[model samples]
Target: MHDEPLPPGQDGQESPGADQARSGTSLTDDLVALLEDGKTYLEAEAAYQKSRAGFVADKGKWGIVHGLAAFALVHIALIGLVVGVVIALSRFLTIWGATAAVTGVLLLGGYLFARSAIRHFKEAGASFGDDSP
Candidate 1:
């Protein structure tokens, strides 16, 4: 066979048609095996993707739950601190007086913050409008 001239599409290696003609293996068999391998690969990929998505979704749910829990904890702590402050102040003043004092302090803080904000805005505006070199 090596000494003889190679037949059409029969260069040293056997062709698909030659294999089918000489044995039980055929083009259909090869195609079926390829298709089965592709199906298996696709199924594995799909399963992995679904598993990843489920894992991410569970993490997202846990994150939201934990975030909300933390926010509620902080809020409760703030309220507790305010109550504690009022109770401590009540030793020297009436309940209403203590509450008023706290309110006054909060108002003063708010006013100072507002005044500082206004000053910053005015300074920024002046810089923007200044034409001097």
Candidate 2:
């Protein structure tokens, strides 16, 4: 019998991992890398969500800016509806400001929970393994 490294991508068996390995890729490493990427993404998403609360809560220049932006955008869309337009704008500004504030708070909360999200994803990654390999 002769034992030599298969030329580049010539796998003796048709196993999925074997095929990937023959192509100079490691399924195990790929899986780990994917999990790591997911963990990072989730962490970032969660962070964005959690911090949103604080950002919104701070009723400072930002709050007015959001309120004004919403006011302009929402009212501009209703320019044709003359009746109750003023009242609608008033109500919408209040509600939209509140909504933005709440969203900011939620973002902040998500940011805080990002760590847990990463940890959960990491644990999941650690769970995948084959003793035969």
Candidate 3:
């Protein structure tokens, strides 16, 4: 036979089945790749947000501690001032000498109360963190 019809491939006629198969494979691979990329992006973003939130929470904790320290320091300074004034005024006004001592005691008590309040705030803050709105 001089030229019997060559098969589809030999004659260069593209088969529809082959084209459909390749198209299906390509679509599947694209979907898989897109899913992986999305997963990676979400993981990285979650890590960054967590670390950043932790840092911000730590700053809040430090602020609580600083407030406690400041409260104590101010009371200490006030007590010292009152004591010094009382002693100095003793020469001029003997009747008011005890007033300074009472005031000093009250200020010291206030310092202790402030410390308690600060501790409460700190513990509460620690228990309730940035996770909440």
Candidate 4:
């Protein structure tokens, strides 16, 4: 049924040497493709991290505003409590006496709290091998 001879390299089946040469070329192409893929993955990761940091920074501004508002509210509440206590004590003692008593008690309590906080700070620093007095 065959009427003409086929070309040397155009036969139906590839030669063994030709297959080896093609495989060598394919290996190099695969290496280059792998490197390109890795570069793209790294660029994507960097972009994602940058986006996450921007999101946190944007939210951080509101976080600071809310935190300051809460802090101010707490101080206002404490002042109101102090005023209420002074008014209640005025019924038992003179106005000036009640004010002096409350002031002394508050000062003593603040001093004790300050001492306790200092002790705790020292203990925490000691755990990190700090020897500073």
Q: Which candidate is the best by TM-score?
A: 4
Write down the lDDT that model 3 would get: 0.83
**How many Å off is the CA of 6 in candidate 3?**
33
For candidate 2, the clash count comes to 20
lDDT of each: 0.89, 0.73, 0.83, 0.89
Error of 4 at 61 (Å): 1.9
Q: How much is the lDDT of residue 58 in candidate 3?
A: 100
Distance from true position, residue 117, model 4, in Å?
1.2
Better of 2 and 4 by lDDT: 4
Q: Which regions in candidate 4 have their CA more than 4 angstroms from the true location?
A: 1-25, 130-133
Model 3, runs deviating above 4 Å: 1-28, 95-133
If the candidates were sorted by their TM-score against the true structure, best first, what order would they fall in?
A: 4, 1, 3, 2
All candidates: CA RMSD (Å) = 8.9, 22.2, 12.4, 7.6
Task: List pairs with backbone clashes in candidate 3.
Answer: none
Query: lDDT tens digits, residues 69-133, model 3?
Result: 99999999988987777777677767375676667777899999999999999999998778767
Q: 5-85 in candidate 1: lDDT tens per residue?
A: 665564566665675776677779889999999999999999999999999999999999999999999999988887888
How many angstroms is residue 9 displaced in model 4 relative to the true structure, after the best TM-score fit?
17
- Model 4 lDDT on a 0 to 1 scale: 0.89
